[model samples]
Target chain A: MTVKELIDSGKFEVVNVGAATDTKITDVFCCDLLSIAMSRGIEGAAWVTVMGNINTLAVLSLTDMSCIVLAEGTNLDQAAKAKAIEQKITVLRTDEPEFKAGLYIHGKLG
Target chain B: MSDTITLKYDVSTDDFTRAGEASSDVKRKLKNMNVNPEAVRKVAIAMYEGEINMVIHANGGVITVTIDPDCITMILADKGPGIPDIAKAMQAGYSTAPDNVRDLGFGAGMGLPNMKKYSDDMKIETELGVGTTVTMKVFLAA
Candidate 1:
């Protein structure tokens, strides 16, 4: 599913100004641990997490992730958001919990 | 073609944010060299895990990556409180990292196991109070 669809579903809210709507996601991996995500996540997969930090953007950039969805309405701080913008990573916020967001993305893209 | 490249990076324990810089650089180089995706991913993951271990456990270290047509070898050497039990450390879900490290999204105890899963061969050398060095290799498919 597209980022547009995820936003329209009302479960996820797009909080970041620089989120990439043009990218297509092939799969979704849900994890809070950056190292495990780095090891298991396939490139271009959408990552769903509850953590909001600068390292998240760094990890996303290293893995070439398609986008990042912050679960449970979590939002990034200014510095983190600025880094995301600098890195050109798509960042989204969702009201759904980690499990629900995972299920939503999985049902749509799986 | 005699394509071989060796690169070295010094991991900084002072900067948690820059821990994975070396691994990211290696990933970009391997991708630019047009290595196979699977092989590149394996090398990237293994090296990244080692890098994190260096910063979190060892107070930093040095990483050397040697890439040839046939394989990629990564050596991570660090000066820190070495693991007393290599066998125990290798077990999944065993971590000594503090809560602060976990707050930053690591310390899951999956690093060593994940490194082993990604690489063709992995070896560790350690002394309890001295330090630890981990060497891993990923072979390119013929």
Candidate 2:
């Protein structure tokens, strides 16, 4: 599904400015453990995480994640968002918990 | 073909924020060197796990990465209290990291296992009163 469709789904909150309207998400990986995510997450998968640290963006870059959706009302720190923007990575925020966000994204992208 | 490249990094103890910098830099360098994506990913994950382990368990350590045409080798050596039991340390959920480290999203006890899972070969050398050195290799993909 396209990032625009995800935004319009009304299931997420856009708390950052890095969302790209035309970006596509092929799969979803929901995890807070950075190592597990790096090992198990497919390249280009949408990352659903509750972490808000700057290192999270660094991990995303290594994994080559397509987009990131922060769950449980967690928002990206300003510096992190800026670095992500510099890297052209899309960032999304949502009030849904990590599991629910994973389910919702799976349902849409499946 | 004498095209081996070596990179070294100093991992600081108890520094959660800078844990993965070395691994990330290596990943970028490998990508630029036209290494296979799968091999790059494996090396990145394995080395990153080791780096985190160094910070969490040992105070800090030295990571030396050697890249050649046939394989990539990572040597992580730390001066922290050595592992009492290599078998138990390799378990997926047996961690010696304190609760505070777990709060940072690590201490999951998957570090050593993940390193072994991703690398083609792994060796552990430790002394109870001294330190530990973990050597992992990922063969270049054919």
Candidate 3:
């Protein structure tokens, strides 16, 4: 699904629409550890994690992930939110646990 | 773009939130220079891990990136307590970062391992209570 479709699905709350609103999301991967996420993250996947810090955005930008889904009710701090907007990273939020978020996206991708 | 490009950054511990700025800047520069996407990713990840290490473990440090036609060399030097065991430090899942750092989504013990994994060549020099310097290279060759 494209990012616009995902946003329109209403499954997640929008934090930022990101630079590429129509980029096709290839897959969904869940990991809280930034390093592991960086190494294993798929280029166009949506990352589900509880890491809501500036470094998290940095990892997203570096890894070229299409978007970040803040699961388990996590929210990026002020600095990270600003960074996300500045870097044009799509940021979404879901109150569900990370596993649930990942599964939802997985099912959608299928 | 033929001339070798060298970039230096001073990592500071005064603000933990800005840890990856250096890496992000380098990534942008490499992308502008039209470095291979794979090579740019490698350099970004490896250097980012090193930069975070400097912030969390080493108080702060200096990172010098030299981009030649064939390779991108990153030298991370810090004046902090040195690694006591290189072997253990290199092992995955062994970390010395405190709980506070872990809460920030770091300290998984993957920093050094990730750096080594991404870079084409890696080297480390450390002295107990003195400092540590890690040099990593990512080749731009296809």
Considering the true interface contacts (CA pairs under 8 Å between chains A and B), give the fraction that model 3 also has: 0.81
What's candidate 3's DockQ score?
0.83
Question: What's candidate 1's DockQ score?
Answer: 0.59
Q: Per-prediction TM-score, please?
A: 0.90, 0.89, 0.96
Error of model 3, residue A28, in angstroms: 0.3
DockQ of each: 0.59, 0.57, 0.83
> Which regions of candidate 2 are displaced past 4 Å?
A3-11, A19-23, A77-88
- Per-residue C-alpha lDDT of model 3 across residues A1-110, encoded as one tens digit per residue: 98888899999999988889888889998999998998999999999999999988888888888899999899999999998888888899999999999899888886
User: In model 2, what lDDT does residue A56 have?
Assistant: 77
The local distance difference test score of each candidate is 0.83, 0.84, 0.92
Off by over 4 Å in 1: A3-11, A15-21
Task: Report the alpha-carbon TM-score of model 2 versus the true structure.
Answer: 0.89
Give per-residue CA lDDT, model 3, range B101-129, as digits (tens). Answer: 89888889899999999999999999999
What ranking of all candidate models by DockQ puts the best one first? Answer: 3, 1, 2
Q: Which window of ten consecutive residues has the lowest lDDT sum in model 1 chain B? A: B14-23
Clashing pairs in 2: B13-B59
Quality class of the docking in candidate 1, CAPRI style: medium
The order by descending lDDT is 3, 2, 1
lDDT for each residue of candidate 1 in A1-110, tens digit (9 for 90 to 100): 76666666676666664556666777888989887788777677778998788777767767777888998888887778877777667778877887888787888885
Considering every candidate listed, which one attains the maximal lDDT?
3
